[model samples]
Target: MKQATAKVSHRLRGAQGGMEGRFRLVLVVVMAGVTLFVLGRGLFEAPDAPDTFVNGTSTSPGGHRALLHLLDEEGFTVTSSVDRLDVLNENDFQDPEAALALLEPSPQFLDKYESEVRGLFSRSWRPPLILVLPKRHYHALQSDEDGTLVLQEGIYSIDDSERVLQLAGLGSELGVRRVTGGDVIEPDSPYATRIHDESDEAQVLEFTSAASPWRKLITDSRNRTLAAVNPLTRVVVLAEPDLISNRFLDQGDSAALARHVFEASQCRHLVVDEALHGMATRASLEYLAVRPPALWALLSVLLLLALFAWREATVLRTQPAEVDARRSREFVIEGVARLMLRAKDFRMAAQHLQQRAPLALLPSRAHVHAAGVAGSTSASLPGEVAERLHQLPENDGSEEHLIRVARRVAEIRREVSLSHHVPSARKPG
Candidate 1:
């Protein structure tokens, strides 16, 4: 028993070390690929760039393209709000014709357009306002050829979410709270399962504020509300953005929950915010690749690879025999021909010999035309070559038969080369 346990432990240790080494190799390859991609992006980038935020212009894990497409497919006319609050006020809102989707606005945006936001949302006669909170800070990576910035793998942060609540006048009734150390979202109620967490890596949203009179739409496993609605104000807040985001909409019941939220807005027309995500400037390759930690990590990986290579070169070995420094093209061709013959690929060897055959064996195009016997003249070089290949006898396709066919093709090429005035490729020059 002791011996068996010891062997098992030893094997486990070896497997663990092998896994670690494989992980390191994969990481190094990924880093090298990313470096090449960034360099290439920098070289061939366009001047203008597109917006890849929740602006419905992208289908990346971070963007809201899926939601927009779903809404459109469901027969709802979804429009985009690229301008500031001026466009909101210009629309007919008293009859609830449109629902405004305020998606992941930066604190800077809230501060700049605070009054405009208040004016639109605070109105008693306005459409339903849906606030989708931001949970992370993302740096735009590559841009499409048409110049659209792609957002992915952002660093998670819960900062400034409260500021968004304050801007929308919900700071008093509800607060934005974050709970770390949480993985999947579990629901407390049946309706809450509509926005269920299927992903193990799903982020959690907690409410720090005292319980308000607002109706809870969804909650975390701890029964803390993640989504709520205030019927009086006609305002709805979704604490977690991934429920409607491209990343998790198709996961679990997210799509159904998202549609339910939109239907609750009670508006036929919808407007998604794009101006808040900073689409004013184009994203450059330098912006994506020139980060301090990333640069350091890449440099460290490269240094490690170089050290490994150097260590490998330090091993002692028998001195290799030196050969002639130069060789003619004919010598290289002959060597390749010999390798093909050894492989027993008769067809390939014959085709190669045919390609290298002299051009002079075939009658000139001008001479063929001058003869004025065009209908009878099937003696073109390509025609004759095809005929020669066709004339090759069928066999059981054994290695011996293949070798015979190759030899015959080689002889034909040699005869054609001798008949041609063209400089022979096989000649020792």
Candidate 2:
């Protein structure tokens, strides 16, 4: 008995072990496939979107497309908000690890959207806001063959930036420092600090508010603020846009600086606000919800659920039951016939029978053409059933009316079926 029990237990254990191993393998394979797909998308995704000055999604020479890609490689999930500032109040953005980047805002943008821009810092519950001040002053040289504005540009001087700052309502405290000769910034430090490759003429911009008492997050040798943050509000101001712009992204420590900005902001999720860049967008979860792998997975789940519901939603009709008013008999009526003659079901059925009557009485090819002519055609319920139908009651659902209609249908069906079998010369009555 002990030997038999042991053998049975051993077999059961082996079966369970095999099942567990198979399940684990399936899980790992699924996870690996997802990881590869996500990485592949990040690696091969489109570089940019259409927009104006300092677009984070635009790959133009003045855009931050490269930096966005770099941020993705560094494990940051970047999205562009073209529609709304729904993120400001969204629960996901409420996390401390989320940041909103307002790319180089020209003076015109600030003039138009200063309230909306300032709202980012004013909100009680918000993500870290990084405001990158404009570096290039744009002047259209000429329109290209594509009607695109070709700009002749030079860096915005400290005094030149005052117009934008004043328009942004950020006060004129910040300045852009231009140093002809400088040193290589140490990699040991954060990206938000000091000007890198200044000897190469790196543009450095600073933002500070005496009222906010923000500590310098990015600065140079003279401690001119390149970026700074308010300890209380968690707002980050990156004065220079060059550090992450497409033109300078690959030059020196800019890529590293971009990564450090993410780390220093304490945010892994970042949104590049493009609504102010003239890209019409609204705040919506659809942009994030449809992100790859998740979309496919959602569709698969929906399909599975649909199949399961189809299989499990079996609705067995109740067996029909009715008895004659005065008889020693119990007759089982069909479910539909037994239903009360209400306006809904029976009225529709009566109309259907009326429409089918002429087809039943006429030869198949007789009812084909318009203007009293005829042609040959055949179809299921919807097509060429009849040129005309027997008139049906508009509202009456009385038992007598139902019986009369039923008897007429039965006669028509009998005549048609018999006519088909009898002879080609025989006509349906």
Candidate 3:
């Protein structure tokens, strides 16, 4: 009974351990899944709000929404101000009577849209256009019809024969006279007369001091006010950009002024907030238009390689190498001869010759007298004996004549030693 109880306890413990291991595995899997999910969200999600627009430009999320609301209220279809040109071109907005484009002065306005501007003017079916120029540098604004117009101060009127009338002036004076001072009538102005009203809706317009030279247009005499609605081509140019900034859309009566402008304009007006136009995309396209000389570059590299191969094949050759082998043998013989001549030692030369010619019969010192060879004598040996010594054959066993010549060399040494009367050692000692 005790053994049965013990067996049951062991089984229970094993089961418990198995359950705990399974739970840990599940926990690990859940944690891994959570980590991967977080990483994927970070990688694939849109960047934070700050990175949504270019630096130094306002994203104006509220202002953009407010503008859309104003447009809708005025019975006009509203679209995002982002990449306005692409939207216009994609929709084939070349019907002049159908729509007008409202543009603000920003980096995008000054740079990327230059070609689009030219195209718009040149096209017979182009839409009416409006551009906001800074009041301080208003002199820089040029009219394609009449060259350039320079404005120093105060309000100036332009009379272009085209259907669109372009107006550039201080927004503050326009706002003060029209909205705040209850002078809602500009009867002489072509389009302003159509939109003016003395109702509470018209009084809802706000104003602020000019924050910049561009802002001076949005101020009263105190240099503070909302932007003025001066028409360009059924299009209106507002001097101060901050009225449309994300921060100020909800402040004071700015939203009302924005609404009034949209209601007054044509239903299909192309509202181009220059801040949202993508200069990077236009610049990238321009860069792609100018192609690199890749084909020419590749041809040049291939030609260089071919020339290199041709030069190596033609200018260099591998001969039979007889010259190298002959050179090697001559070098060895001359080197050995030089060493023997420099040392002036016949014994050392004989030893070297013996090592080179293994089959040669080498004479012992005792054979010096019998070989008729002089030994360390001041007396000169005959030139014939010296010549005979040099002529001694390099011993190969096939030549009997060489063996006889070796015996003759020994006799010559002996005769020279006797004639010189020099005692010679029996061996080279």
Model 1: how far is 58 from its true place, Å?
A: 2.0
lDDT of 2 by residue, 229-273 (tens): 666666676766777778867765667765665566777888777
lDDT of 1 by residue, 306-331 (tens): 67655544755443221221245667
The reply for model 1, stretches above 4 Å from the true place, is 1-52, 87-89, 92-95, 142-152, 180-211, 279-429
Find the candidate with the highest lDDT and give its number: 1
Candidate 1 positional error at 245, Å? 0.9
**Model 1 RMSD, rounded to 1 decimal:** 26.9
Candidate 1, backbone clash total: 3
**lDDT at 401, model 3:** 45
lDDT (Cα, 0-100) at 327 in candidate 2: 23
User: Candidate 1: which pairs clash?
Assistant: 49-147, 50-147, 50-148
TM-score of each: 0.46, 0.46, 0.30
Per-candidate Cα lDDT values, in order, are 0.63, 0.60, 0.42
